[model samples]
Target: MLCLTAQSALQGRSDRSAWQYTRADTPGTGSVRWLAVTDHFHGEQVLRIHVVAGPDSPSPGFPLPRAGEVVASPAMQRLFASTPDDQLDDRFPGEVTGTIPVDLLSHPEQLIAVVGGEVPGMFTAAGIATSPDHAFFAFARIIVGIAALVLLVPVAVFVVMASRIAAAQRERRLAALRLVGATRSQTAAIAAVESGIAALAGTFAGWLAYEGLRRVLASSVTYEGFPFHAADVRAPLAALVLVPLLAVLVSVFPLRRNASKLPTAVRALPLAVGIGGLFLVTYTSAAGFDELAALFVISTVVGALVVGPWVCLQVGRLLARARSATTALAARRIEHDPKASFRAASALVFAAFAATYLSGLVSAYGDLPGTGIPPGVVTVFDGRDREIVSDGTMADEERIRTREAIASPNAIINTRREFVLRERRLWDDVESAVHFAVTIVVVVAGCGVAAGAAGGVLERRRSFALLRASGTTLGQLRRVVVLETGVPLVAMTGLGVALGVLTLVATKGPLPTPGFAAVVASGLAVALLVAATPLAVLERASGIDAIRPGTSA
Candidate 1:
């Protein structure tokens, strides 16, 4: 929904010119003369338009003469109303004003443009031609794209983990039914019905959650100086239907994959490593922000998918060489089911990558030169002599006039303070959004880790019971469980931080020492805590009581 809204906003801005111009006679076609005027009033910029409206005006598909009262023929008024008072008051101070017809305006010299026709193509042309506006819009589009990617990646990770949990429980139940003489088709039907019900309930809950979030964001979040209202956040009716259907499909499709085979993990490892290497190369190659950002997102996602399993397998192999019986048991369990541990910690890996990138980007921005000239200083140049002089203070009007008078202005008029200020604001907004997004991702990842750990305990209840029955103390079993969870988590967290720091260095960004340390520490602490928490709960329950003979398989 957020992605959709962002796309819509970009589209709206792109079509702004078409929304402001329309022909009167044909209503939606033909040519008409128009003028656009821009000026400053009461410290705010105002746009006013004067159109040659007659019986042959064209319709531009949206509200026109957006800020002023209308003084047009009755025919034009029938086609379009004057700008509303509230809108004018909100955007421009003072009393409401109406648009003026071309004939009604006293001075034609004030017109900024006298275009020949009501050209819908003019908006695109003007947008591209205006450098400042073009840069602003480009930055906005990139920021939106980045935000959407950040938002979706964590959600995708969470969904996959959740589906794994659901599939594991369903597979076990189906296996139990199979042992009771139920046919394959019966088992499939039962599983489908159960998944469908759960999917529906989850979909409804998600819808409610989205609505609640929309309400909060509508009140709080703004983009490009405009608030995101409820209408802006509303998803189409088709999405409402398609989303639930998609959820059901996602829930059911995994059942077809052979869980015994580790081929997917093996395949993902090469892809993840390859992508990470490619991203590092791209970042260090001085590529454009667009390309670098694309590679960064792709690498983080692929890395998250493979990092957990890879780390788990490596730790398991190392622990298998240990002499202790408990260590050997934990190592075998992790090696046998690396996927379980991966599902628990994968989200955290991605979160670490995101946090690291953002911290580096912010630090880089902070290192930019602050060479802005202080106010009240004036510099002047004498022609041909090439001598510059700095002396008295200049008023706003004098500064504007001086800029206008200079034929080839290079030094005095090219102060970078405004540009730096704009850039700072843009990055600041992006940083704030990213921070909020990362917090949400971290919280969700923590929940997933905790839940996955608990699910692992439940799935291995029979094994745990057998160990206890064989005279392994409850404390020893608990230690095994902790080792099973902790080793993989610690290893994966370190790998994640390393990848993040590599990205920072590759991008020529500062390391942000304190920030990086905090992220690493917090990530490791939260991961270990979440991973080991389930064992603490299980300490209260007797493992032997969970044993059942048929449950081993």
Candidate 2:
């Protein structure tokens, strides 16, 4: 199979260059000059050669037959033709060359009877010729199949999920167009148009990425084995179209539901969609599906987003019940006004999910456990954690001291060598761990900041308007916004760090410096980001009143 496939990639039929000299001139020298032979497509069986002595050398001539090329009489060919493919292997004699000998056939697929040399051991062997085997093609097919399977998850997550979410949003957006004088058919048409545009754009981008990856893989893989073929665009195009259509269909019910609601209730549409989305995700996760892991990850992050406000409200309520005047007032206010409180805090959930997953994945990159927090902390802080860091220093004394500190019981400590990738070195598995906690922590916390910002801006539009009217300068308004978001960002990130530490302790039983630093930094950054969001939004939106009343702020 491979040989057949490799034929296409061969340089083609041409006798490769070789040099030759007459044997007579070099007889005493006993040296052979280079010679070239043409074997255009490697189609030749063998070359029969007669090396005659020149006037200066011996008179006799020597003859040799090429590898896998048999020099058999008519009777021999007829005799071997009857031999089965399996049985012929044991009957073949050694390769026949000139007086001296060398192994000629290297490939397993090229086996054929050996023949023709006048040397004492040389004997003509009967043989038949058949098409050579192909291994390259078969191997390439397997790799292509695996690559296709690997891409399915991304396609489902990005293309399918995006379409569904967009479809849900389209219904409401289109219905709004209808109430404003657009026809129902027109609304649907607009949705179709939107989906088509989105699909096209996404497909184009996906193709570019595919081509880039294909090129990269091609350079690394030898065409003689697994050849690189451009991934078929048809599948991805179909995905773009089908996913969006399904998304649109999914949105139909929600759109209809919201369209029937009075404008007052229309204001609550986001909440309803959010709640339904939550249930949908939960249900989907509970059911097994292809790429279930990715689905769970996405759903968990989204779930966190939708449920954040509710979570905050609940927390506030808990605080209120503790009979602390300040916290109680705040909690009651949050609980009583779901729209305002929930929307603002919704971003926190995004941050939290982002933080957790990012941290988890980054930490997973190494063999070490996560951050150094104990497992018991989860009962208090959920499962958030910090990133790990390495200070590039190892303490032999500290290790000894810690060992001695455990005097109450006998504990065995053994040191083992491990390989780790350095700046210029290759990666290796090692007992000594690299610290990634700090990086993961920071990344996760950053996600929280972004979510918090988006949520705060969305939730406090009216409040911000009021503040602007009440003589709050844009700077002050922005400050207030930041204060609101930053608080939650900090709190959650801090908790995440602690949780990260706890996770490490629970899992790795060690918190290396790198991991510890990552967690601490992550917590601090997220906290600051959370605190900064409201203020930033308020500052930006403060100027919105200057626009036409209906224009987007």
Candidate 3:
């Protein structure tokens, strides 16, 4: 929202001024003429406004009249605009062009709606527009949205894992209340209140963090030319109310699930069929089948949710046939409760797939050369009294005559260079933002994986202690835990990569080989480290008291 507001302010319409003058040589009293020219500078679009002060120009209402004119107000100029440089060209033959009377400049309130002129081929709206300036804004929004979605995966996983950490205690308490004549509904209500309280506390902390971040953003410039204002950092009232409500609901809902009831093969088969159907439609349809493309993405994600655990179970069964006792033990655990394993790792699976898909999308569009205006086409802009040379076919004499006739002149001689620069800047910004978001996502996912692995080990303290008391060595027991996590994680990652590749192929995008390889490698490494950590701690302990019934170690 901050980005959107800044861009909107930069592209809004200006109010009409009675002091405005078009001619550079106007000698009338209380009149000031300004020349605004647009050009590309340092890989960005820049508008340079030159002031032409007359002998009888009006008094500028502020102090330091000619000391670098500003948009909105002096403070805003320091925050949003680049420092003024007097070195830029202001020469116009037979005309006086230098500095405008400051009285003609916009006041603070009017400056918020002051984009100088119309941009070609753009749609306009109340706080939104479709121009080059707005393009950067749109791209920024997309980057932030992707990051938020990726972050949600780890947060959701953490919530579920946290709830389960005290499951034994919760169950015992509920059982006691039941024995004392508590109804099932009453017990469920009590559990809901407990979970809701924790969630509400976390939500409050998150709200405070958001406010601090908002303040920092308002005072800083993120991109080269965009600065956020205090007005841009407003949080919607509805969002503030909804956040805590959502946290409470998510905390209580998962507790009602019946873990023993396995999801049926029939439930997943239809999703596979739907995905295949979408792929076929996309391949067979004519060009510009955007609806089909969107459907394919939705189907693929849903299909992963449905089919992922089945694949994990099959892989576990194959590993169970191995002669190694550690591998067999790991495989049996996964085969016995694949759903639980899948639930713990599903977020990682989704994040990997999203990263791969986005990589391919970027690779497909990022490198194409920009197209230019065709030959033999002359482009001219009407400057009201005279013409302006924008592109093509005009002789040198004609171009010079047109420039001399107009008060504020501009031209576009090389369209190809401008197009290329604009396209390159757009893609560079997008890729940079994506890389940053991906880094954040990977870190969060790694933490969740580690926490889940530790929780799983704690839950199975008795089983691990029994194995350790028997003939099993600590190294063997550790390998078992590693296999338990590593196998399912590797299986899920492979499935995600396959789905990503299929999407790229269907959309006629290039395969991102290096990116896919990196995602897969990193995911496996994180999973291995998470699994090994618990066993490494167990190896140092010299007790078997964890195997005692009804006791927690």
Give me the runs in candidate 1 sitting further than 4 Å from their true place.
Answer: 1-5, 8-95, 98-154, 164-182, 236-308, 316-332, 347-351, 367-373, 376-415, 467-490, 512-543, 548-553
* Candidate 2 Cα outliers beyond 4 Å, as residue runs: 1-176, 180-189, 195-311, 314-463, 483-497, 500-508, 511-513, 516-540, 544-553
Could you tally the backbone clashes for each prediction? 16, 52, 4
Each prediction's TM-score versus the true structure:
0.64, 0.35, 0.65
Question: TM-score of predicted model 1?
Answer: 0.64
lDDT of 2 at 262: 13
Instruction: Write the number of the candidate with greater lDDT, choosing between 1 and 2.
Output: 1
Error of 3 at 124 (Å): 18
Task: Report the lDDT tens digits of candidate 1 across residue range 1-553.
Answer: 5434565545443444333332232233344445443322111223444444334444333223322333332322332235342322222222223333432211211121222223221221111111123465677768677766665555555555555553566787788899989998787667557657766787688778777877676556655333443444555455556545655556556543445644245645644554566555655555554555665556556756565676677778899999999899889988887766666666656666667677677767765543343433222332432322323222342344234222322222323333555466556555556556655555556556665556566666666777778888988877787787777666655666666777666556676547556656665666566656677656534455667555532
- lDDT assessment of candidate 3: 0.53
Of the candidates shown, which would achieve the greatest TM-score relative to the real structure?
3
Write the residue-wise lDDT of candidate 3 on 1-553 in tens digits: 2222333332221211222223334333454434444433222344433344444544333221232333333332332334222211221222211233233332222121112222222221121111233265466566655566565666667566556754655677787999999998888788878877776787678678766776675455333223344444555455445545555565455453455754557656645664676667656766655556566667777877778777777888899999999899989888888887777667666666676777776666566664332323223343434333434432332343334323334543223435665666555555544444444444445555555556667666776787788878888877877787667666766777677777666656777747547656764675556545656555533248776676554
Q: List CA RMSD, all candidates.
A: 9.4, 21.8, 8.9
What is candidate 2's lDDT per residue for 283-384, written digit by digit as tens?
A: 555454433435443443454445444444455556566554434433554455544433323333333333343344444445632222121210111133
Q: What is candidate 3's CA lDDT for residue 201?
A: 82
**Cα lDDT, all candidates:** 0.53, 0.36, 0.53
- What is the Cα-based lDDT of residue 246 in candidate 3? 56
